[model samples]
Every structure is written in C-alpha cells, then in structure tokens.
Target chain A: MSNAIDRGKIEALKSMLLSLHKGESIEELKRKFKDVLETISPVEIPLVEQELVREGVSISEILRLCDLHVELIRDTLRSSLLMDVPKGHPVSLISRENEHIAKLAEALNVYAGALSKASSGEAESHLKAISNILAELRKSRLHYRKIQMLIFPYLERRGITAIPRVLWGREDQVIVKLRELSTLVEKELTHPKEYPNIAEKAMEVSREISDLIFREERILLPAVWILLSEGEWVAIHEAAKDIGYLIPIDVEWASRAKLLLPYEVNGVVTREQVESLPQEFKFAALATLAPDTYEVRSEEDLEFETGFLSKDEVEAIFRHLPIEVTYADVNDRVTFFSQSIFRKGFARTKTIIGRRLGYCHPPRLEHFVKSNVDDLKAGKS
Target chain B: MSNAIDRGKIEALKSMLLSLHKGESIEELKRKFKDVLETISPVEIPLVEQELVREGVSISEILRLCDLHVELIRDTLRSSLLMDVPKGHPVSLISRENEHIAKLAEALNVYAGALSKASSGEAESHLKAISNILAELRKSRLHYRKIQMLIFPYLERRGITAIPRVLWGREDQVIVKLRELSTLVEKELTHPKEYPNIAEKAMEVSREISDLIFREERILLPAVWILLSEGEWVAIHEAAKDIGYLIPIDVEWASRAKLLLPYEVNGVVTREQVESLPQEFKFAALATLAPDTYEVRSEEDLEFETGFLSKDEVEAIFRHLPIEVTYADVNDRVTFFSQSIFRKGFARTKTIIGRRLGYCHPPRLEHFVKSNVDDLKAGKS
Candidate 1:
C-alpha cells in the first residue's frame, strides 16, 4: 500500500536526521539517503521531524540537524514551482522581508568570519559590525510573526499542522540565538576573551536563519499561494496592515472578493486543488485532512463580547446616526469617522481614513489636538 | 476675433430659441437653424439657456423649446462617443438606473394611451394602473438625489456650474409634473371630467423623464467620466452608498488609486485632456473654466468643527486607546469597533465593520440588544 511506502520513507528521513545529529557529516548522510531525499516531499520533512520530536529527539538537536535536512532535500524543494506573487500582496511582502533578512544573515556571517581572522588591533571594529548585524537580524521576528499569526491559521485549519510547527521551531531557535549572541557580543566588548566562541555562535544563528528563509520561500509560500483563495488573501492582507510590515509596502492590491476566514473552509482539498499544488505539497494536499469543526459566525459577521453582527448592518448604523463621530487610534492615526445621513458637520470622506490625526487639523489646531491626545493618553481626561 | 464670432453665434441661437418660444413649428425652426444646431457644442446648450435666462427669457419658455432644441441638435449629440463604462462603476450604475427609469417612462405613456381609449367601466382600472406606475416612477427621485448630491458637486467644484443647474431644472420639472399627475388621477376617480387632462399630463411627464435620461447619459456622464480621476470616482462611489440607488447595484468597483478631490485639481483642463473628451464635450473641456478658488484641507485630512486632523493621526489615537470601543448607529447596525493594541474585547475584525449590532452578539442577547436600541431611539435611556 502507499501508506507502507510513506511510512518507510519517513523512517528513512528520521534516521538520516538522527545520524546528522550524532555528528555524521551532512554530505555522508545525504549520500547514504540520496534516493530517500530525492523522493521526499516538502511536507514529509516537517512530519518526520515532528515524529522525531515526539520520540524524545530534542528540539535543539533537531534544530542542529536542520541544515543537514535542508541540504538533503534542497534539490527537491528547488524544483517546486516558484510563484510570482503580486507586489504589495501579503506573500510578496513576506518574501521581500525574507530577502532583507537573508542579506543581514549573510552580513552577520561575513563579519563573524572577519572577527575570527582579524588581528587584535582590528578586532574591535569587527565585533561592532557583528553586534550591529545581529541587532538588525533580530527584527526578522516581525516577519516571522506575520507568518505565524496571519498565515499559519489557514494551514492549520486544513490540518497541515506539522509544517507550521517545524518552521516555528526553527524560527524560535534563531530568535533565541540572536538574542544570546547580542548579549555575548556586548559582554565580549569588555572581556575580549570569548571572541572565537562568539564568532562560532554568530555563524550558527546565521545558518539557521538562512535555512528557515529557504523553507519559507520554497515550501510554505508556494503551498499557501496555491491553497488560499483571493478572499482568504484579502482577509490576511487586511489584518496584516494592523501588524505593520518590514518594508514600505506598495499601493494596496485591492480585491473586490468577499472576505473568507479559515473556519469557513470545509477542511477538504479536492482532487483538482491537489493537482494545482506544487510538487512539494501535492501529497499533503491530497492527504486526509482533519475537518476544522470549531463553530463560528460567517466571516462577514463580527463576534463582540455582547453578540455578533454582519458588516452590512454595521455600516448602515453609522450612516443613520444623527451625530458625526470620528475616532483616532492610540498612535494618532485617523482610522475611522462616521458620516451622518442628514448632515456632515465638516468635510470628511473615506480618503481621510488612515491619515494622521494631527494632519487632519489645520496648522493652528494641530498642536491643540496633539495636546488633547497626549492628555488622554496620560489619563488626565 | 473669436469672441465676436462666439457672440454672433450666441445671438443667432437666442433668436432661434425666441422664435420657438413664440409658437414656431419645430420642423420649420430646425430648417432655419440647421447650421447653428449642427455646430452647437454640448456645453453651449446649457450656457446659451443660462444666457437666455439672464436676458429675461422665462425658464418655462426654454422648457417649451427643449423638445425643439433636442430635435434640432440630436444628430450632432448622437455623434458623440459612448463609453463602455465598467460594471458597478458610478457612471454605469446611473446609466442602468436610467434604463429602468426609461422603461417606467414608456410604461406611463402606454398606460396614458390606454386610459384615453377606456370606457367608464374600464377607466377606473386604468386609473389604478396609472397610480401604481406613478408610485414606482416617484422612486426615481433617489436616482436624481444621487446625481444632485454625489455627482453634481464635482462639476460645480470645477466652476462648470451651468450644466448641473440646467439639468436640475429639467429634473425638477419632471418631479413636479409627476406629483401633480398623481394628485389629478386621485381626484379624477370622483370627477371623471378631468380624465383627458390627467392623461395628457402623464404623457408630458413621461416625455420629460425620457429627455432627462437622454441628457444624463449623453451630456453629463461622458463629461464627468473624462474629467474625474479614479480617486474622484472612489470618493463618489463611497459617498453614493449612503444615498442608496434606483436599481440594485452590482458588486463594488474598487480602485487602489489615491483619493483626489475637485479642489485639488488646478481647475484647468489641459489641451491633451480636451482632445480626449467626447465630441459633445470638447468645447466644454477646452473652455476657460473659472478657477474654484475656495481653500480647503487636503483630501486626506478631515476638517472637524473644532479642528482638522489628517487620517493617520486619527487612526493612531484610536489604536492607542486602552479600552475597546464598539459603535452601532441609530439603526442598530455595528458601524465601527475600536481595535486596541493590547487585548481585544472579543474577536472583532475589520470584516465586522458594517455588521448588524444584534447579529454581532449571541442569539440569546439578540433580543436584549434590539430592545436597548429601541429604548435609545425612544430616548428613554
């Protein structure tokens, strides 16, 4: 049966990772499992790794073998289709952040190499460069946060849990390592004794970050691009705006598509959907997916602490109100304002949405509004 | 030199219109002014009419001459390009509503004809049918309301004031006639002597509505479509939603273009812009438009009664607020909910921005929410 072959392949992948963790060379392990590596699907690597974690193989140990695992299956992932995500779309923004993260990772490694070989007289500059790169590299957490928060839920709803778990584990490891490396580099600024050790740690974190980027661009984005509908993407894109982006985003990629939430999907990937998926995800897409059974309102409906309401009803209420209401968020951004049916007290249009509160006022009143906002923030009002 | 020629043309047009007002036959007048009618621009009709009013020619006289005027220049206006407006766009929506309005107008005429031929027994039924059609016909006011509120302001802001004024005059006449016909029909049920008079008024109103529709589709839409940017269309589309429509609108036509207000335009239509306009509008587009010199805040800034604030500052203030806020309008529609930076009160997303307040709550609380809304409307709370 195909199940037998799948089990055999996962077992082989697990052993190869275990051999790499036990100090076997990646090249040697890759050669020994060349046939298995070539046949391994992108989704299978994560499943096997999750299995190893359950069997008491430590996360750090698996993290150590990640580069080896990535190396083994690099060719297979590389051959999967690369989607041309449109500019300003959530996927495109994530991919752009990864490119920036990759450059910083490479910079950290380069400066680490320089720190290792630099004469004692020139060692301070290299340490400073390494520290700067590490701090910049730490900002990749925002990039990772979007993936975990905005994208993972859609995949988890489809029962594709292993990929998120494995990717998250690697991302967490890099985050922790980057923090420690920053602390170590600062301490070394005075002691100057752990130069070689700090250099080695920097290289390790750099490699881990690089490996995660490869997995995201090759495995995760391509799979989601195929699986998520325009509605889901619209939901993701809208929510992601609140979280902020790592880059200056382009003009919004407006979608007239209806909003769709993860809970709305039936958790079944049809044969046609599977056929459209990249080679890296075809098996996972075709696999039996556990239905997301959590009961929820329609995506157009909002569940407040009191009850639920659809979007149409909400908009109607605002327009029907007698008094005009304007709301500025904590950061002084003009996020929303109400338009009364009979009269608008002042000239306010949808264009004013997302503009700065200070700028909404004339120059004379700008200071007055800012002070009022400050007073409110200080709990004086 | 061109001003003299323009003056001579206006004088000739005035004389021809005065002759028509003096009970001249339309066919005879068309022969007399064939050259002037052929060369008359779309904007000139409104301008010359405005002039005639300034020179003491009554609006009723001009209204009487309208059919003659339309007949004489119909061939030239017919040669103007008809744009294939995209579905759901404001222009397309207006045109679609006009299509429905035209059908009602035709139906009114048909019923009026039928009423003229009906016996005393059949006359009451014809009167009932006329009343039903008139009730439906009166709903076209909502269509006219959108044009007056949403579309006309953009033109007026450009200092092209004559067209909106002339069109509104025609629209007002049709509305008043429709009302009077409804009243006369109701009274005719008791006193059948005025049946012929009621039928004649119905035909007249129908013809007027048809003429207004022709003017809207041929003159106004084509001109504004050329003048307004995607941003302006976005603003118009957003504002028009509150006014409702004559017909069920198609899906929203979204544009990612930045919002541009009429005041933001320099009030000058360049040579290139004039060239791109429809043949009927070329003279208007090229004319020396009076500058709209009223100063205002940027389109992205909202001018409140107390002060003004740009959209960004307003949004920031809302986001930084500690407590989550949800707002429902007078109609119990949930128009807005504040998104706190920290903990959210519930699963309120942007998707629920326009939802019904009752639907946003649990089923058990739906009744409670409804009563609270009713009590608020009653001003008891």
Candidate 2:
C-alpha cells in the first residue's frame, strides 16, 4: 500500500487543479473537488509532488498547487478536528491558550489599523493599546515553549521528527519577530516617523501568530490527539503545570492511567487504536505499519538481604533518601549513586557514574574528598 | 536533652504511678497527677520507668503503673489528634475507614451478645448478622496492608522503626484473629453447640480490634500527621488507590507539592517545623536534634554532544522512550540502560548495570545476544 499509488486518483486530483487554474473560484472548486479530496489522502501529497516534478511542472508551481489543495481541504481538516476535550486536560488547556492568543492577535491588527488612521489625539491612545497588546502577545512564548518542550518530544520519539522540527522552527520565527517588532514599536513611540514601519511589522507578527494558531488547531494538536495515549497526556499535563497557562485552570482533570513514556509505545498502532482514529489519520496510520518488537516490561522482585523489592521500588527508595550517596569501586571509578529528588549538595549526572571519583565533585572540594577517600582506603579514617 | 531527663519530673511521675498502685482509681489519680502530667512528656516515660526499676519495683507492677499513666494522658492524646483533613486525603481516608471498621466491630459485639441470649429460632438471624459483620471486618485487612506497605516504609526511612513495627504486629494479630474466628464462626453455624466458645472468641476479637482502633487514632495517626510532609501524603494517596478504600472517596484531593520522600528529609527538625508541631510532639522534637548534614539539590545541566540537559531531564528522556536501550562497556559489562516505565520484554534490575551482558538476559537469549555482539565487534554481518 505504501509503494502502490492510485494513478486514477492522482489524475483526478491533477484535473481538479487544472480546472481551478482555469479561473474557478476557491468556493466553486471546493464543491467540485469534494469527491477527489476523499480519494487523495494527506500522505499521498509527497508522492503526488514527486510525480508532478517528474513531469514538466516547476517546484514553485507544485507548491502553489499544494496550497490550493490545502484551501480546498480546509473544511475537511476542521470537520475532523478535536472539537471537545475535558476541561483542564492538556489539549483543552493548550487550545484555550490558542483561542486567547488569537483574540490578542486580532486586537493587535485592529490597533495597528487604528494607529495608522488616528488623529494626533487618538494616536496616543492607539499606540498605548498596541504596546499593551504586544506585551500580552510576548507572553505567548510560554505557550510556544510548552509545545516545544512537552508535546514535541513525544512526536520525536514516535519517529515523527520532521513535523515537530518544522513546527518548532516556525514557532521560533514568531517569537523572534515579536521581539524585533517590540523594539521597533518602542522606537516608533520616540520618533513618530517610524509609525508606518512599526504598524507594518506588528501586522506581520500578528499574521504569523494567527498562522501558527491555525496550524496547531488544524494539524499539530489533532494529529497528536490521535497519536498520543492517555498516559502521555497525563505527563504533558504535569509538565505543563510548571510552565503554566495563559488562562486560569481551576478544574482538576483526573485519570487512573499510569505514566507511559514514548519509549513505552511499542511503535505499532493496533487495529483497535487505528479504528478509533479520525478518517484523515486512519488512512495514513494504516498505510504506515511499524514493527511491534522487543518491549521490556519487567516488574519482578529482586531479593536483597533485607527484603524483596521490584526495581521500581528500589529506584524510588534511592530517590526519596535525604542524603547524597555515591559509591566508588576499589579501582576508584564511580559505580552508583542515590538520586535524591532534592539534590542540594552537589551537581552530578548519570554520565558521571563511569567517570573517576575525583572528577565527580566541584574542583574546590575535589582534593578534600580525594584525601578523605584515600584515608578510608588506607584504614586511617 | 535526649540523654538527660529532669529528676524532679521523673520523681513526680514515679509518685503518681505509686498513688495509682496504692488503691487509687485511674480517674482519681488523673485528677491528682494533672501538675505532674504537665511536667513529664511521653519521651520521659522511659526515664521514669528506669527510676521505678532502680526503686526495686517489679516489672509487672511498673507495667500496670504505665497503663494507668496512659489512661491519665488519654485526654491529652485525643486533644493533639488530627481533627480534620481534606475528604480524599490519604490520612483522612484511612481515618474514615477506621471509623467504619469501629462501627462494624461494635455490630459484631452486639450480634455475638444476641446470639448468646436468643432462643434457637432467633439464633439463625443473629448468626447471619454476625457472619455478615465478619465478612466486612475481613476487608479491613486491605486497610492494614496499606499501612504496612505504603506508610511503614516512610516511617522506617525516618529512623522511627519501633512504632511502625509494633503497630504492624498488632495489625497482623487482628488479621490473623479475623481469619481464625471466620473459620470458627462457620463451624458454629453447623454445630450450633459451639455457641459459648464462638461467642467468647467473637468478643475477644472485637475487643482486640477496638483496642487497635484506639491506638491508631490516638498514637499512630497523630504521630504520622505531624511527621509526614504533604509530598509523602500525596504518594500515600496514589499508592492507596491501588489497594483501594473500604469506604467510597468521592472528592478528589489535590496538592501542588512535589514528591518528597522520607530520605529527602534532613534529620534536623527546624525551629519553624517544631513551632508548627502539636504540643505532644514539640517537646520530644525539640529535645532530640539530629544532624542536618549534606543534601543534594542539583539542577545544573550536563552538556552532551547533541544538547545540554539536566540529569533529571536525561533520566526522564530515558524513561519516556518507546524502546529499551542498554549500553555495555567494551568488557561486555552493562554500564547504562533506559528504564522504560513499561518493561514488557525483559525483567532486568538496576543491579544488572555492573553485571556481564550475558548474565543480564535469560539463559536462552544470553548465547544468542553474545554471538550477535561478537559479530558486531568483528564488523561481520
């Protein structure tokens, strides 16, 4: 199915594009291309691009054709989108933040338009509103940061690296443009001649933010909603709490689902899981079958001198201990350490486990610890 | 302060103990020993016992004296108890379960009395009621098991071993008695002539369970409430969910406190912590000061070839991965491995880190893995 492309479906989609190129309005094309849209899935877009390139079509022309295709399928994307989620859920909270930012972006555009049209008296008030909106818009970085940190990693783990990287790149661009536009806005306040430039820049930043919001709501989040499990959502909710929300999250979303990491996902989307997915994802997911091989799920007890404990219990015991305890072998190479959750004494990574004990401590305390270790080794302590 | 006890206070308590032994009722002694009770703390019990021993008092006599002292302090212990907690909090839930079990024990006693008094016709209904009560009482083992598993480990880590162990002993007795009495009750249903013996055993079990309830409410819970932090309670609540509650817990108790284990507690109880403690714990807490010692609270990032990540971040990255990744040194000794949350394929503990790679797997897979490693080492397909 991955290798075989339906030539008939491709020809049908290409003819739809040809019909639109011959001066058919987008609305008119949408009505005609509805059947063709169902036939051509999103995964087939790359292959279609390849086939179109192999013919006499230019790359820029293909991109224009793809953009027209997206416009035609916009309703389909919205219809298959995440319409409702439990309040306080990660997806719901993120979508709420997106809604808030969209309003701010709309307000920014309105203020920018007002500033350009205002009389001298109204210009002050309009500029003030623009600055305030920019300040609020700047806080959306927290929203974008959460997307990059909490959500993107799961996609990366599932081998969907390109999408997250591309989205992150666009998110970073929005952040950078906002910062530069803020500086320009500040300059505009002093020299009033720079008003035109600031207004243009603000509108551009506003447009970029709106575009990202559309991409998130239509593509990224809906796709993630299909791909990530409840356990992954729980983790995202926990990590997102530290980053915080644009709007207050008063309700507590509770689930009995255990914490499942990306590595815990066996790569294969089972038939039941695929069946539950929306139409847009089902075709792509069914076509791309990943191997469900070699998972490690061991909860067997390990007997110690004191008692029997599972590895998780042992790990938890070590983490909860108050003091730092690192062990060095007789050869003086680091072997193990207790990973106290509140590690206040010294900074050490698991990478330090195989390193020499001398390199484990801060340089100032290195000699003192080395001497103490030596004294103990020599039975002099 | 731990080593030294006020001799005047000890002598006062000794005389009070003597008064109880010399034909005074516990109620009369309690009235007389009000001032002496203020002078002597619970920690001073051992010191007063030592003084009584030096005065040539018999151990049995001193034990009776101590029992009288406990009766005198009953009001004081009750006064310093955990009066209220959020509905779904672990301590609150456990206390609620205790209340339910106490009512069941009372019903068991009532049913036993009725069975002994009723004619043969009424005995059937009375016995049925007793059997039902016994079934409910048996479920209390879930409650006891939680205390032993979830709560005791924290107390053990805090170096307060004896209390958890002693309470656990009494809890085990209740469980064992309930099992034995359940079997005997079945026998009584058939034989009917065993009513006298069954009634006597039922009363004994009822008394024992009631006594445990008194101890848990007065001593165990009050001590635990004072000693445990919010984080510990959160962990207890999470673990208790798996064991389940005897009563329904409708409300979701929420806390923002991070998971702080017993080992994370620096031994010293700060002045602020002491100030917040109930009157019963303050004196003992203030007198016994332990070393604050070394704490590890590092959040510094470790630079890797790809990017900089905190140790926790690296640990989390490993945990959340969808695949089990184990790295061995050139010597074929395991150095590091991803600790996947769901270890489905193999049961390897952290102890396997320094073990030879061949021994890390099952015997059958050991040779297969070894051959593959050798082939890779020699650059063979």
Candidate 3:
C-alpha cells in the first residue's frame, strides 16, 4: 500500500546480511529482526539491494548473499511482485520464455531420473533420453545468445554491470558445463560409468539454469521495465530478431507499434492498414523501455609507438603472426582468437568467443591446465 | 660408469617413480629400491623421466612425480651430472646467470628473514628490502623472455615440446607471481599487515627461483646438451643475442663463431682480421652441444571448408573482430593475443607468449579466474 521505500526496513535487511557474513548464527539473526524478516516483501528485495550497493556495500558481498537472500524470502517472494505485463511487449515475451525454459529444464531432469544407474531399463532408451536432453540443452545456447546480445548490453548501459558481471559469468559457466557433459555422453557412449555422472551433472545444471531464469524474471525484468525507454526495447526486440530467442513471441507491444510504424502518419490508421495488418491486434500500452546503443566508427589508421598501420594492416599483422592466438579474459571468457596464416595453431569459431577456457582442450588435460594456472597465481610453481 | 644405455636401469627408475605415484609408502619404496633411487643422477632423472613418458607414461603423470623424483635424486644428483663448460660457451653463460639468480634469491630470502615479525627492522628498511627484491625479481622476466624465444621454438621444432610445455609454463608462472608480488608491495606500502605476507611471499618466491635455477643447470642444460645440435645451440645463442639473457655473456662460442663467420680463404691469422672482429669475443667451445632443428617450409596458405584465407586476411579478420583475444594453450602458456583495433583489451607483449595464464590478472583475481575455469571443467557451476 505504501509508495515510499522504507529506509528502516532496508537497514534491517542490510544489518541482517552483514551479521550473517560476520558468522552470526542465523537463529540469532532471525531473532534480532524477526518482525522485519517476516514482513519484507520480495518486490522490495532488489530495490533495497541496489540501494545498499549504491551506498557502498560490495557487489561481491551481495553476490555471496544473493541466493541466501532469495532462499530466505522464497515463501513471501511470490505474492508481493505485481505483474504489469503488456501483451506483445519484449519484457512480456522474455518472462514467458523464462517459464518455458524452466519447464524444459524440469522435463529433462525428469527424463534424467531414468538414468541414475546403467541397470535402469534398456541402456539404449536411457542413452536415448540423454541424447534428447543434450539436443534441448543445446537450444539453451539460443537463450544465452539472447541474454548476451540483448539483456547484458542493456544492463551495462544502465550501469547495472554487477549483475551481468557476476550472473552472466555464471551463465557462461553453465554453457561450458553443458558442453562438457554433452561431450562425455557423445564420446564415451560405450562406458556405462559415464551415465551416472552425466545424469547428475545434467540434473544439477538444469536446476541451476531454471533458478537463473527465475532471477531474470523476478529481479532483472522489473528493473529493465522501469529503467529502459521505448526505443531501446524496440532495438532489443530488433536485435532479438537478428539472434532469435528460445521461444517465439505471438504478440507485439501495440502502443509502441504506432511509434514503430515508419510510414504511419498523424495518429490515423489507413483503410489498407486495417485490411493488411494482422487480423487481431492486442491493446497493450507501454511507457516505452529504451536502452542506450553505442555507435562504432573507424575513423582512421591505428598508430603504434613503434609504427603506424591502417586497420587492414593491423588485422593483416595479427593474421600473419607465425602462431595462432586465442585470448581468454581475466574472467576466463574467450574474447578473441587470431586466425593465423602461418598455421592455424588452434582452431576456434565465433561461438567459442564468449565461452570459458575449459573447452579448448581434451577434458583430461583441463585439470593440469587449471592447476598450472592456480600455481602460477599462488606462486606455488 | 657404464657408457651403455642400460634398459634395465631405466625401467627400474620408471617403476620406482610409478610406484611412488601409486601411493606406495615412501619407506617401503626406500626399502625396495634404496640402492637405485639414491644413486640416480640429475641428468639421469630427466632421461629416465623422458623415457618413462615415451614408454606410455603420461607427461602429466610424470609432472605429478616430478618433485618427488627431484627429492629422491637430491643426494647424489649433484655429483653425477658433469658439466663440460667451455669458458665462453652459451651453456656456461647460462650457468653463471643461474648462479647469479640463485644468489639473488638467497640474498632476498635472507633479507626477508628479518621480517618474519613486525619488529625485524625499521619498517623503512623492510620496505626498501622488498622494493629491491621486487626490482631484481622483475628481471626474471628477461630470463623468461630469452627462454621463450630462443629455446621453446627450437624445442618445439625438435619435437621436444613436452619440456617446453611443462617447464616454460612454470617459467611464465614465476614471472607472473613476480609481477604480482611487485604490485602488492608497491600498492600496499602503507599497510603494516601487508608486509609480513610480503615477506612470506618474497621468501617463497626467492627460494622457488633458486630451485628453478638448480633445475635449469642440473637437469635442463644436460638434457639440452644431449638432444640439440651445434647449429641449434648456435641458433639458440643467436636468438638469445636478439632477446638477451638474464645476465650478459662476456664470452662467445668461438669455434662455432668461426664457423658462424662467412668463408675466409686464409687459415692464417691476419692483423686486419684481429682488429676488425668484435672485441668482446672470448673463446668458449660448448663441447659442441647441439639440438635437432626442423626446417619449416611455407607450403601454402591455410585452407578450410569456409574458404581459403591468406595469413594477412586471417590477421585482418581477427583484428577486425570487436573483441581482443589471447590464446593460452592446454599448458596455460600464452601462445598469442589478437590486437583489436577497437580496444587494446589486455596489454600483452611478445614477452607474454610462453608465459602462463596467471599473468592475465592480479594475484587475487588469478585465483578467481582459475577457480571459474576449474568449475567449468568439472561441470560444478
């Protein structure tokens, strides 16, 4: 009923979280703030959380507590947030797709339940279920592509980078793990021992992924709805068209459609438009959610301390290097790989760019690589 | 001293190493193979280690046993690997630099001995000692750069890539840790709590540096001597000339240098020849240790199903991409980074190649990246 955010309620939540981090017993934490803990609505969670961060609570600390916060609020979380979905809106479609993805993950996990042991029915059917799950999991890549291209850039432009930094990294980890599990199933099909591990990994991944979808819908979508402008959502929907989503939308945001129509004039609908347009148009109004877009211009040649080169020349120089180069960022996300002319040192594709470092080698060698990296970091080597 | 390649002797060593890995009690191992283990030479350790790898032992498996093998052979490992160093030999110069590095390390560790407690010295002197060590530790970069450029390419060409893979990755790691320690000391000067940790890290790093030098002189040099050819060593020395070693060589490999000179008709010494030659040439014959070098032919441009791309075009394509990329191979040694025209993402140089992935971030974030990578690989995320 109240429009104003309660600063005292937020402080209670913050102190509870800080106390929890200080190794305070959860029982004590609950006892200390029993009234506030029970009364805090899920709708206020992100608002208070964001405000805490703005007031200098560490993003990493918030990340450490995020899921725990969600868990604590799970019961009261459902009834609080009011959905004001506009039919055919980009946010509306994304919310629907989140539900679909959760269903898909649940369906796979149910099928995977048949695969706890190699002795469960026909090995052939069990493996078939796994193969089918792998196929559907592969479609999650489309979900990821949408998030990376559409949502992340929008979040970043809104200075909501912490979520993308922490959350999208988790997404990349999920994809890499999915790929790993798929490879295990595909390559080691004859080994029955691989089945149990596959089922376990698949179930875990599916559950984690479904949880991610919930976070997006509950925390992220509402924030985007409030923060973004109309034209930005239009750009996002347009980009999503270029890189499709997990599920197709059956509706479009109608109030923005008039603004979207390039040839429409004076708020008047022509007779031809009435006949040619889709038979039924949903009446949905939006205050428009627009995200900022960056413009890239290649104005001139790149000059280095040692020499100068055109963009073409710089590209040529990298390509001409005797060895192939692939770069994984500090976050282990593959950002680029040079296509070597001398010899294609390591084969890489565009899709691999946003993935983590785990897939670049045979799975067995991954540990050794990882250990060496750790030792290098810890000065143990 | 048998000059013969005794098959039984090699097998015995391999089996001992394998048994050690199999978690055979070290006491039992000592009882079973006490005679052989104590007598194994430093040169024989790598020889047996390399042979074990060739005989179906995984290189990674050997890596696990590497330290244990070093420990087992520590007693008489010193006496058996005889150095036939000529005064001006490249090996001799490297050996001298190893001594310098070891002493440098020992000196720092000794200085670091003061700071175990906060009361070890004036905070000013403690900081100054750390600063000096950091400056010297930074020079390990030169030791690394030379090895990457001069030795690794030659090793890979010789099909001796396993050594480069393991050893060079370790070197890259050392350089990265060195860089990390330097940053911590530089940034955390005002924090007294940071100094004891710095002291501990510096001591660890210095001791490791000294141990690395010992490995180089005792194991690697001897291995290089046996495996490489005269021209390969000359090429290594030549490449070393380009890259520079940790410390400059006051001597030259002259028999090779005379051969390095273009055809001179007269065998007799002339006054003009003596005057014209570079004054710094000191006679050092390397017992003529050389490595096998591969002749690389530029057969043609790389062809893929997508289309053929010239080295230039491939470079252009990578440079044209929006993201900067660097490739660290399965060993975590950085092989390459693409220079994107849009943003110089990670400031990488030629020196970074043959270095580990640890160099990509701060010491704190290195663990974060490594853990993420391992989690991705393990399918844990």
Q: How close is candidate 1 to the true structure, as a TM-score?
A: 0.34
Q: Tell how far residue A339 is off in model 3, in angstroms.
A: 16
| Tens-digit per-residue lDDT, B162-211, candidate 1 | 56666776776777788888888878877877676777788778778877
Q: Candidate 3's residue-wise lDDT over B12-111, tens digit each?
A: 7678767878888766876898777656654354445445544655444554444544345434433243345565566666666665565456555544
Regarding lDDT, does 1 or 3 come out ahead? 1
Q: What is the TM-score of chain A alone in each candidate?
A: 0.59, 0.55, 0.49
Instruction: Write model 2 residue lDDT over B1-381, tens digit each, in one string.
Output: 274677787677667767767878877876887787776654345445555555655444555554543443344444355766667888878877876776677557656655555677867776777888899999998888777666765554444445655677777777888898888878768877767566668767877887787777676777677777888787677668867889999788988887654435544555776676655456656555453222222345443321233445445544644555565545665445555665666433332333346544333454699899999689685
Kindly report the TM-score of the first chain in candidate 2. 0.55
Error of 1 at B358 (Å): 30
Best by DockQ: 1
Can you give the lDDT of residue A142 in candidate 1? 77
Q: In candidate 2, what are the lDDT values of residues A1-381, reduced to their tens digit? A: 274678886686578667766878767776787777777764455456456555545433454454544453344434364766677888878877876776677567656655555566656666777888889999997898778767765654444545656677778788888888787777767766657567677777876787787788777778788778888888778768867889899678978898654435555666776686655456656666453232223345443321233445445544644555565555565445556676776333333333346544334455798899889789684
* Distance from true location, Cα of A35 in model 2, Å: 27
- The positional error of residue A309 in candidate 1, measured at the CA in angstroms, is 11
DockQ numbers for every candidate? Answer: 0.02, 0.01, 0.01
